[model samples]
Target chain A: MRRSIVNDPDDLVAEALEGLVLSHPTMLELDAEHRYISRKQKARDKVGLVSGGGSGHEPLHSGFVGTGMLDVAVSGAVFASPTALQVLAGTKAADAGRGVVQIVKNYTGDVLNFRIAGEISGDDAIDTEIVLVDDDLASDTGEDDGPGRRGTAATVIVEKICGAAAENGMDLQQVAAVGRTVAQRSRTMSLALAAGTHPGDDEPQFTLDADEVEFGVGIHGERAQRRIPFTGADELIEQLVDPLLEELELGRGTEVLAIVNGLGSAYPLELSLAARALHRRLDTDGITVGRSLVGSYVTSLDMHGVSITLMPLEDELRELWDAPVRTPALTW
Target chain B: MRRSIVNDPDDLVAEALEGLVLSHPTMLELDAEHRYISRKQKARDKVGLVSGGGSGHEPLHSGFVGTGMLDVAVSGAVFASPTALQVLAGTKAADAGRGVVQIVKNYTGDVLNFRIAGEISGDDAIDTEIVLVDDDLASDTGEDDGPGRRGTAATVIVEKICGAAAENGMDLQQVAAVGRTVAQRSRTMSLALAAGTHPGDDEPQFTLDADEVEFGVGIHGERAQRRIPFTGADELIEQLVDPLLEELELGRGTEVLAIVNGLGSAYPLELSLAARALHRRLDTDGITVGRSLVGSYVTSLDMHGVSITLMPLEDELRELWDAPVRTPALTW
Candidate 1:
């Protein structure tokens, strides 16, 4: 329960910025009217990578903004979307002679904010492209004339590959195209064994049975489709893999990038074991795993359980993934 | 509460071996007779890097025994030491025509077993050298005979650097020398906000009051020097930093590597924040941090807390750290 902080919530952002600077002084943190982090001024002719969502996912947006990844990360309050102005500030900070590509997860507010920001930052010289990531199939697809459920974890994988594509000197349009392709080709399913309590909240955001686990849960602890009895890990992984494979059309001979991400409180051993099991199931389906990453890449605070993300990799996507890129979250 | 087992203590090791191979078919698990994983009999003339310790710290002794880091890792059961026979088996599995360098953490049983294994393996036409890591500053270093206290989290950093060095074509003796120097320069201190619980055990290995925490704790939940009131993270980090700096004799312009390692259960956000705090303290002391890694490199089951390791790095250690290596735990 002990935390390092100044007095109130208003100062939370500034205090946290100070801590980040203290921890990673070499990594640039711009403490200006509109805060953003960058290693250097935006590069001309190189595609600009921008990503933003909520602030609670530390080292997610901001920590990931660096040389081979995001040029700027616009951070909002805990689980809250940044205002359009904040997004615009980040875009402006990251904009060089080349255009900027915004990697926005498909949260309703996030989409709206980034879209408005893009319009506001429109310039003849500065083109802006927003790639919406809605890889979570558990979110209602909204039958017709509606966007899919808000994007969650897969945004990270898309950003990583897109960042690499951009770093390899791809133009903004090309980078955005790669980003969209990666997002469309990826699918994620998460389960929650416990809810995460807000920093100041005494009680958990929600409740769950000690023995029951909610599958396909949201990053914000939203109610899942169903709470099922706790069973063996292999069964849980099988349930996750089945939905993901079906969604991504993965079968024998399909090359995949398997991700077994921890939702915070799950043990590493459990996550690795679940990843191992998930890989086996994918193998049984004759799916060829080109690259596999097993860790807590995108986490939901300290919630217990795990998520499986299957990225059916094409040749272009696999090459983009293998490119040398540096980010705090996805370091290879 | 759910676990798989064969119900015989003696059979536990064999069952675990089969489970490991079955769990990870992608990984070439060494068989029972020769527990070594290799690409083929004639893999390469690469300087073989090996690391081993107690088994409870999963993904450490096995997960990291792939391409880049350690060629082989001998795993002991739970927190117990791996037998010399197992070490010899792993050595044989990793012998790719070049010499083998053994990385032994400063635990008594592990050091003893690895030393005996090296002696035995050397007799079989393989040139082998052993590097003993005695980096835990909290241990009873006053004893001149050798390193006392458990070699907790710092072992991961040593393994990474040495593995990187080996990957850079360093001979077995050279890798061992670099590892030894790094170990002497490194010091670590850990804290536990909650005690670790062994699987199937009713209670934790130990206990802590609601407002108390164990400072300078061993990774295995062994008793620490003292139990004190739970102070805020800054004060606690200050306590850890002072001891580490004093022990390492860090001065202005001294380059050091910082490792803020989670002992399992601590969330990634918390670890990131702690790393930020530790970095700030080091900056104030005018120390230059060469490389900083924050993750659960070596864990003690589900212990909830973190350990900080500071290694005063010179040019050689820094060069070795940057050497390109591939392993499951570290890839850069």
Candidate 2:
């Protein structure tokens, strides 16, 4: 298992941090622990948005840390969630005396860690608001009384709009309400024809036959619900839309912000086709898609598949969506 | 070949054009015969900049046809250059009522076609200037003359900075001069571990042994200078950098803008490591890198290789590079 950096496992995070800092020196200011990379100037009189997760998804949590997006991004080891201390440090760094909002995807590990971080943050005068992203409702959230699998790609869009709202002088609680509304409105489902290899590991996390693909896979190589036959892209998208449409009950005159995200290894051509299929299907279903994006916004390493997330638009939500944001992960 | 669209060879361009207009209703306004997608709003008397090339590189010509980069992008067929008619129409669409400058990569087909377009455009009241991108030093450019092969990916950076400059109100002549200066000062070389296949095409344009990589391959699968033994990224960077340094005469106190572009299929991780190697080698050689980028900015389908481009920066050149232009292909 050969990786690019220092031989020591402990040094990997620090070295990667150094590299990230060098690349985005102007936009990012990192503290000594390498725990958090925040915007140089905190948002004065505005709710600070903080997001983080595993380290492998470059430009995801960290790349998104800059103007118009996350105030601070905490880092964990590859495919691992950040600790409470790390998240707390990030929250503290991003706090501008105006409350802090944590965008946590619904992975049990992420939810628990961020919750603890929030508890620790409560000691300060600032308030802490947590918006859990459980847009992927493939499985029961209450299964075994455990936390649901976190699918937070849409959290990026939500954070951007909500961040824009905060940037435009919205109060903390109001901005947070908008964020929660977006998270509730968005839903995503993913499929992978091949799994991504963990760094330093040659073999992929999982494998599939050339003609077969896994449906509803997680970023960490979790298996999906069904193994269906390989067919045209239309069928693949139908599998996704059928379930999603049922959940959203989207109908005529319902405008949606459509996102077709590659899980990694998926080519732009495929992504475009998938986006087109989803768009075509939505149109057939009499759903009005206000905005559609086809690209690798939220990837799962080099997993080969696509995830479609639809965010139903309301007045406030649409305004936030249209607001300007300056983040490395996503840019208008 | 299994292309994505359903149309005749002649109508393929129109179909694709319709798709682009449909997909990006806001950013682009196309003149199909003339291959132009202009910003919907009229320009503010700034220098009008236009760039286009073979059509296979999606989002390159069209995706980049927005606010900060190019004002006009004229696309040809898949891996083919556009006709003079297309180029002229594109010029008309992008002309902003100010003198228009065309940023062309110096391929025989592109040079000839764009030159014809410029000549036709010149006959009109519009002032037309041409900045040919002859940056690829790896291939001989002359029938019996100087330099090497046709212009490759470095054209993107030249287009980006020049577009930025033009948008910042640099006159047509000034923008053309900047484009020409960067094109001359810049040099690019590429190596391919695998050849790319056209959409729906199973066979690759070229092939390499599993353990070998072809160095200095062209965008259309042209043969490279060598196929060396497979090695680690550091060794590969050394191979890429040694040539680039010699070509550019980069040394201590020299500021350079480094672009590590994926020819497709190459993942971001590999690109990152390669950028790391490039930075280290440049630093070891006493060269000061002002900025660095690693991504698939200008790709060749899904070919698996990377190209390294270096532009020696001067005060005026830096200013032009810093200018803010709007286009889809290049952004700040």
Error of 1 at A57 (Å): 2.8
* TM-scores for candidates 1 onward, in order: 0.89, 0.89
Q: Chain A only: list TM-scores of all candidates.
A: 0.93, 0.93
Docking level for model 2? acceptable
Q: Looking at model 1 chain A, report the run of 10 residues with the lowest lDDT sum.
A: A1-10
Residue A166 shift from truth in candidate 2, angstroms: 3.2
Per-residue lDDT for A1-332 in model 2, tens only? Answer: 11221224454555555556666667777775847888866667778889888866565777778777889988888778999999988888878888888988787778889999899899877689888778886654654776665664686777787788778877778878878888888888887766777655656787676567687877778887777665566678878788788888888889888787777655554565676667778888788778766666677666667788888888877877777767655666
**Residue B163, candidate 1: C-alpha displacement in angstroms:** 2.9
Off by over 4 Å in 1: A1-33, A123-125, A144-147, A200-203, B1-47, B66-68, B96-98, B144-147, B164-172, B199-204
Candidate 2: deviation at residue B125, Å? 5.3
lDDT of 1: 0.72
- Write down the C-alpha DockQ for each prediction: 0.26, 0.25
Candidate 2 regions with alpha-carbon error over 4 angstroms: A1-14, A123-126, A140-146, A232-235, B1-23, B32-35, B44-47, B96-99, B122-127, B140-147, B168-171, B203-210
